[model samples]
Target chain A: EPEVTQTPSHQVTQMGQEVILRCVPISNHLYFYWYRQILGQKVEFLVSFYNNEISEKSEIFDDQFSVERPDGSNFTLKIRSTKLEDSAMYFCASSPPTDTDTQYFGPGTRLTVL
Target chain B: AQKVTQAQTEISVVEKEDVTLDCVYETRDTTYYLFWYKQPPSGELVFLIRRNSFDEQNEISGRYSWNFQKSTSSFNFTITASQVVDSAVYFCALMDYGQNFVFGPGTRLSVLP
Candidate 1:
């Protein structure tokens, strides 16, 4: 089965530096989402994108966070300035237009902000 | 407001023993969706099951079964004859129409051999 895939499975960056986490959702899926889980914490929603635009974003998705579908298959999450708290497992997910309620998640990118 | 609650923080069972993970949700919308995901030691979230509010049917797939009770707003998962591979953290999530998924604090299950 086709699955969501993310790049840079493990990323280490200095605090205050910018970082980009990339994801390639399922080929035909329309909606995309980003979620994060701090170590030992519940996964938190960050943002959702459809038609190349942000459809919904949570409070944690502040100014420092931005998502872009720069190309047909590549969806990227950029953190303007990484903070220690930003260190977490960032997951990308997608759902087909017909089945928006069921999302398929990627393996996740472990971002470690030093 | 939408919320998902997984009351059991952790559970332990010997191999072949059955285990159940509880999930309760609060949502005002008459139409909503519930889901369960598993995250093993590798830290990857694996999709397990999804159920909508309208379908309260109890479903069984192999050794895994799901109980969807809309009256109590609970979606529970049961693993029958669990193996060592069943050891993982399972998450229950709730989502309203046109909204993001609200995940519950996961329940970690340690199936010992």
Candidate 2:
């Protein structure tokens, strides 16, 4: 079965440095999303992207965060400046054409900022 | 606001035992979707099942079954005769028509031999 895949399974970055997490969503899916889970915390939604635009975002997705679908298959999340609290697992998910379609998740990228 | 609750933080069962994971949700939208995902120690979140608000039917597949109760706003999952392979962290999630998705704190299951 086809699955969502992410690059840089684990990353370590210095505080105040920029970081980019990349994902290749399942081909043929139309909607994409980014979510984060702090260690020992619930998964929290960050932003959703469709049609090359942001569909929705959470308060946690503030000025530092941005998502891009630079190519057909590549979706990426960039943090302009990392903070210590940014250490967490970031997941990328994609859904089919329908709004109610089931969302498929990727393995996740563990981001560690020090 | 949409929220999902998985009250049980962790559960341990011997192999061949049956175990149930509870999920409750809060949503104001009349139409919504509920889902379950399993994450093994490997850290990949695998989709298990999805149930819509309109469907109250109980579904069974292999040793896994799901109970969807609109009245209680709950969607619970059960594994029968579970094996060690069933050990994983399971999460319940809710999404409204507006595309707001929320996930509960996962329940970690450990099936020992």
Candidate 3:
């Protein structure tokens, strides 16, 4: 079965540095999302992208975060400046065009900011 | 607002034991979707099941069964004769017509052999 795939399975960056997490969603999916889970914490929604634009974002998705669908399959999340608290597992998910389609998740990229 | 709650933080069981994980959700929209995902020690989100608001029928797939109760706003998952491979953190999520998903804290299950 086709699945969402993310690049750089693990990333390590210094605080104040920039980081970009990339994802290649399923080819036919129309909606994409980014989520983060702090170690031992619940998964938190960051932002959702549809039609190459942000559809909705949570409070945690502040000024430092931005998402882009630069190409047909590539969706990326960029953090301008990383913080120590940013160390977590970032997941990329995508869903079909259906209203009630289930979002398929990627293996996740573990971001470690020191 | 959409919210999902998984009350059990951790649950442990020996092999072959049946365990149930609880999920309660709060969503005003009559149309919504509920899902269950498994995260093993490998730290990957594995899709397990998904149920829409209109379909309340309980479903069973092999050793896994889901109970959807729209009246009580609950979707519970039960694992029958679970094995060591079933050990994982289970997450219950809720999503409405909106884009984002609201995930529960998750329940970690350690199935010992």
What does each candidate score in C-alpha RMSD? 1.7, 1.9, 2.1
Question: Which lDDT tens digits does candidate 1 get at residues A27-95?
Answer: 999999999999999988899999989998888999999999998999999999999999999999999
lDDT of 2 by residue, A1-114 (tens): 999999899999999999999999999998998999898777888999999999988879999999999999999999999999999999999998864357899989999999
**Candidate 1 chain B minimal-lDDT segment of 10 residues:** B93-102
TM-score of each: 0.92, 0.92, 0.90
Question: Candidate 1: where is the Cα deviation over 4 Å?
Answer: A98-101, B98-100
Candidate whose TM-score is highest: 1
Identify the superior model by TM-score, candidate 2 or candidate 3.
2
Residue B79's lDDT within candidate 3 is 100
Q: List ranges where model 3 is wrong by over 4 Å.
A: A97-100, B97-100
DockQ of every model listed?
0.60, 0.57, 0.57
What docking class should model 2 receive? medium
**Stretch of 10 with least lDDT, candidate 1 chain A:** A95-104
Candidate 2: tens digits of C-alpha lDDT, residues B1-107 = 88899999999999999999999999999999888989888877777888888889998989999999888999999999999999999999988888788999999
Please write out the lDDT profile of model 3 over residues A11-111, one tens digit for every residue.
99999999999999999999998989999898888998889899889889999999999888899999999999999999999988874357799999999
Clashing pairs in 1: none
